[model samples]
Target: MKNVFTTLLLFSCLISAPSITAADERVKIIPDVVYGHKFGMALTFDVFQPEKPNGAGVLFMVSGGWYSRWTDPQNMLSWFKPLLDEGFTVFCVRHGSSPKFKIPEVVEDVRRSVRFIRLHAKDYGVDPSRLGVWGGSAGGHLSLVLGTTSDKGKPEAKDKVLQESDRVAAVAAYYPPTDLREFVDEKSPYYQRFPALQFDKELADDFSPLLQVTPDDPPTLLIHGDQDKLVPISHSENIMQQFKEKKVPVELLVIENAAHGFRGDDQTRASQAVVKWFQKHLAKQAD
Candidate 1:
């Protein structure tokens, strides 16, 4: 009788397991959709649309160490499958790489991408007001900038896309450098790496998301490893403090003993946290 009960329980559990449907798959991929032209180079993005969408979209900034590069959409499809599983559309946003474009120019490119996405939200089957952004390292820094900066559209702009606000509804980033001015000392590698930003306090502050936090900024989630040698955990801590002071919705997760880029279970945990954050913040709320 006991053996029979165990067999029945196992069968029940197997039957209850979630089945993979066609709607759970990423069915559409639109590559190299040009969002802007800069320095005679085209700024493009790739959209990964799920077979079943939740009316929300996420923009993933494809940047690392201040250098932006093109990434194969298939390579990132697995990394973003969690978001896809939840029926969220994903966009891989690419900006002009550094050394040729500089940080400020990269910032503008990202902002423009956000505006472009918002302008065409309906065509993409996403709610314009329900967009989120996420990234790691330099991409994370740019994501924070999108969270904090809000601009009224220019009425005279030639492109209608430029007239949409660049603001994002939610943000999630991993180990981002929030303050450029804080790392301007002679001993800091970031100071030497980006020489163009040195001695320019105004420009540094302009790019610093820590300095840009406002009361009306979008909800934000930051995840950083406690033992991160490249971008310290204090970066997120300081920014979290600013977010609190300004009454912005923010949360910081510090992964114990993890490094700059999370590995093993730490990476999984960070990714899961990001998925939940967007799920909560990007949901369409009643007015």
Candidate 2:
């Protein structure tokens, strides 16, 4: 039973797909776009361009359990249809997986992907400054990391992508683990299952979103289920408070009676909320 629960918490985030419909046909997909390379592996993401674009981009962190898995971009069309219909081009980003790489390394790969995307935003017809990111579970954790830990580019860097800004305009995360300090000591109930958390104890607070929030952090939306035992609603609540104290724009949507993942009507509501959050925050960036 413990193993089954762990598996569900790890992979359930990927199962919140809405049914495929004609709306999928309105988007053009560009797949396997490499953003960076490390240790002989390519970091890549897929771009889904709406027929009518709103000039903004939203990167969907393609992660669950810190394991970035590849899926048919076609199968994801329905999942992205909400964002596409709103004229936002979507980037499904995959990062280095865990049980091989640790959490810090996974975070670095995602930050590089953001910089790479910002560097080529014009090529994708997206406004580089008008970007947002989102995900659930481990992906959500990454989104919050991006929101709080984003940095201005190193102008002295020789690599052009490294010289590009990694900041995003907004973030929306679902049931993210905000504070990873509990896992630093391997004390969390999930420590054994999520190998990504098996890292140096000193590094936990450095990557924790709750501890990293600052006044300059981007607008953030956090959605969680009240009954989420895997991540717990407190993760969102605590970070929401930090965002508030820092005077950063933030909102929390608590799904009643839901668990680790949303299903049926809950998924629909969660999907719609994410679309609205991105639209509200990403669409209004000044030129």
Identify the candidate with maximal TM-score: 2
lDDT of 2: 0.88
Q: Write the per-residue lDDT of candidate 1 for residues 31-132, one digit (tens) a residue.
A: 999999977889999998988889999999887655666656655666777898888999989898765766787888999999999999998999999999
Across 21-111, the per-residue lDDT of candidate 2 in tens digits comes to 7767768999999998888999999999999999999999988788888888888887888889989999999998877889999999999
Tell me the spans in candidate 1 whose CA falls farther than 4 Å from its real position.
Answer: 1-25, 184-187, 194-201
C-alpha lDDT (0 to 100) for residue 3 of candidate 2: 58
Runs in model 2 deviating more than 4 A are: 1-19, 285-287
> Could you tally the backbone clashes for each prediction?
0, 0
